[model samples]
Target: MNWLNYSEACARNQAVILAELQPLLATTTRVLEIGSGSGQHAVHFAAALPHLRWQPTDLAAHLPDLGANLLRFGSDNIDPPLALDVTQEPWPAGPVDAIYTANTLHIMGWPQAVALLQGAGRLLEPGGLLCIYGPFRYAGRYTSASNAEFDRWLQQRDPCSAIRDVEAIRDQAHACGFALERDISMPANNQLLVWRKAV
Candidate 1:
């Protein structure tokens, strides 16, 4: 029962992610974080924004590692890890005011990624915010040569895992009761896409 993992990238980018989410989550009472891997962002964000409750979730197999990380760095505002698989019918009970997930889309297949958006559509309250952070291609082109290499590396590991298209995600968001709000540039060729659940 030793579940421990470390993600240096999560530590490095936690601040940037928090800065992006601060204003967006200002009035949000509850926020659900999908793929809360290592729980680093969960602890950092929850500690910084004490007003909002942070609910961390991941696949059942990933829960223990997340739980272990939370135990070391968690704040009072964060909740226990919940099991969440995007393809599973009926996501965890919620009408959450905000959702935050990082580096998840490219890791999951296209269909699973779509399911994630669809599940977020169902769980989010009207006007709720969903912030997705990852590398994305635009118009079938990679943003940078490094990104192209990264995509190749990803596909080599798992064919289904590769950077997604921005337009495709935008279209799926529209279908899932979301309206594109902002697309922010981030460090290391990553992008943060924000969408709001239409009222």
Candidate 2:
């Protein structure tokens, strides 16, 4: 039997994410995708953005499924999956053109999330783009009732996991020498935040 991890939400969101990624990634040659869950986006984006070499990374446990997905649908542009834990140092030694992470922060503890941002800062070259996609609270308030409920659910499931505020995220990103360049409102109350590494 063929085995590959699947995520309905990933399938649903990949297109919108790709639309946002295209222009942001147009000038990029190397991209590192953090938390490549299910590898759905890796396959889809690699097929669409053939010019970039997409490096997918995640915790070791997910490597098999991620690798399987890559073997199944990945093209030449998609590199083999790499083991990455944000809290651990030396993020694959990248001076990449772009860094992309989707639906990851809210699921991790805040400290790890901050570490991820810091690592992104170190990974990107000057003027590189950092794209983060997920629901975010604005001005300390949830954007929608559904997002509020989702935050509650996330906290209930894992105390460390909850929606992050745009303000807090900005502060963290700013500390890493990144500046918010674009904030695209995406479907399902999520936001695609683009931060540019200072040149």
Candidate 3:
């Protein structure tokens, strides 16, 4: 039987995410996608935004499924999946017009999340964009009861993983030479945050 990985969340959110990313990335040429789980978003975004050369990456273990998904359904604009652990040094790709990641921060431990932001700072040029899509807490408050439940579930699954605080992330990104440009609300109690590196 043929098998390929899939993410129901990715399937649900790709359209709305694309609506936000389409204009933000219109003038851009390349995009580096961190934690390209199942390669679903990569395929969807690449197919929609053909102007972008999309580089999808994830942990080594996920590469097989990710690569298979990309090979089977990805567009020419989509590159093969690469191994990328946020804590590791020397990311596989170079400077790009923008960096994108979805539903990743809350899955990573705090240190890894910090490292991912730092790595984006290093790889992106001044004025480049870093677009992140995920759930976040504002002023230590969850946007909805469902998000609170999700946080509890996440912590139960992995003690170090829970919805991150927007203020803390903003402060950290600022320290890394990025300024929060936009924080747009999305469906399912999620957010699409855009940051731009100092020019």
Candidate 4:
């Protein structure tokens, strides 16, 4: 499973993300992780936080690698991966305590990102958390030179793929009844945006 290799960025950033997430997740019983690529982060977080159950989901094509990574880590708190594509008509299951997605938004087109937020709004319980982790543009400007290069690389691979604007994302989230709580700066020019569904 070459695709299952751990990212150096994931290694450097997971602990920081966990620190921010630990408080919000303390009361959460279950979390639905969107785009659980490689599954390294899933297993690591699940093992670290035994109280919160982690449900990993990704495209069907990535499931085998995800499953293998989960098994190799051997954590009971992590559930078997589910096939999930946010742009699809219906989500697999719903009403989770929290939803998390890392480094996925910019990889997908704007329509898919909007659909993902809309789906989260539909699936989250009242006041549930929606945490998105990755680098993003702000007010039509790139945050860093690295992100600019990354954006170029993404667009080169798929013209529809490019770094998103944080303000625009917050606007969409607000429209979906999700209130932005925090925008924590992370390593490697990334950020962790935390939102809560308004009651």
Candidate 5:
């Protein structure tokens, strides 16, 4: 299946995210990527950072296209894709050294986002990292005009899919036993949010 071809602004920012992620993930042995859409970022990062094993996962329907993209890159470090849905009653896998998801939260409703964070907390070992990348609202304001427009487009497509407030996300992370580590601003108005599981 072609699996619905489309491009996202987030995909264009992968290299910038990898630059920030590389140093923090230098010692990480395994990384579980949620919502591995198109598998572009996973293949690119796994090829760039050969030391860390990248486990790309998404809904079962998305696996074929994701796998095909991974094959295109031919990176040994990227493991076969896994079927994972945050809203499911139980996750399908074990713990991971780190969890990464880009531009997924805004695509999901608030409840699903909370469930994803809770599941991440459960799967991450103490001191493990959770990295989320995407545009977000901060202090009741949009960080950029482009992001504001993107949020409008998102809500138009799905009322539940709107740019999330950073503060609310931080609060949810805290409730899930995660501590906010860094909020790095990236190109194209996106932000890289790093949270560490409390030790």
Candidate 6:
């Protein structure tokens, strides 16, 4: 058990995220999680949602720790972690009933964010859900002062990384054949945005 790979943020929010996902994913069979990070959410969610096969993925660089964490605490429903860099490639997984990612969009550059949406559109089955959890700007307005400060910190850390606008993401998702279904408020000024693929 490598405590170093643990994420306090993931620990704090996984239960809340699960509460929203449980009912939405009741009928879903396979879930592909992008940017699985330390695998905390994967292990936790897979354990809670035993019926869904959870596939965790991250960039190659993060795979060692991701895989390690999954192996350490993952259940039978959780698949071995795969290497996925949203900006490129075969995605390394079969088609899934749903896609989930947390706090990933703001960490990726704009091009990468676009790629993720496009890829999610390609990978999910019709009527499948694409659930994204993170802070986002709406109509060019920040939701809170803390989120604004967080956005600034992110930009300072990496100019390419900043909070994305919800409208921009919705537009891209629409172009990719997805329809916005829900925008649920979450803790820490973040939101859980749900989109469903057009059937």
What Cα-based lDDT does every candidate model obtain? 0.91, 0.91, 0.93, 0.89, 0.89, 0.93
Query: How many backbone clashes does every candidate have?
Result: 0, 0, 0, 0, 0, 0
For 40-73, candidate 1 gives per-residue lDDT tens digits of 8898999999999999999999887788888877
- For candidate 5, the TM-score is 0.94
Q: Record all residue pairs in model 1 with backbone atoms less than 3 Å apart, i.e. clashing.
A: none
Q: What is the lDDT of residue 146 in candidate 3?
A: 98
Between candidates 2 and 4, the one scoring higher on TM-score is 2
RMSD of each: 1.7, 1.1, 1.1, 1.6, 2.0, 0.8
Instruction: Report the C-alpha lDDT of model 2 over 30-54, residue by residue, as the tens digit.
Output: 9999999888898899889988899
Q: In model 3, what are the clashing residue pairs, if there are any? A: none
Give the winner by TM-score: 5 or 6.
Answer: 6
- Candidate 1 local Cα displacement, residue 177, angstroms: 0.9
For model 4, the stretches where C-alpha displacement exceeds 4 angstroms are: 1-3
lDDT of 4 at 66: 83
Which pairs clash (backbone N, Cα, C closer than 3 Å) in model 2? Answer: none
lDDT string, candidate 5, 1-199, tens digits: 3323435654578779889999989999999999998887887798888998999999899888778877776489999988998989578766788999998999999999999999999999999999999889998799998888889999999999989999999999999999999999988788899999999
Compared to the true structure, candidate 1 yields what TM-score?
A: 0.97
Evaluate model 1: give its lDDT. 0.91
- Of 2 and 6, the candidate ahead on lDDT is 6
Better of 3 and 5 by TM-score: 3
If both were scored by lDDT, which would come out higher, candidate 1 or candidate 3?
A: 3
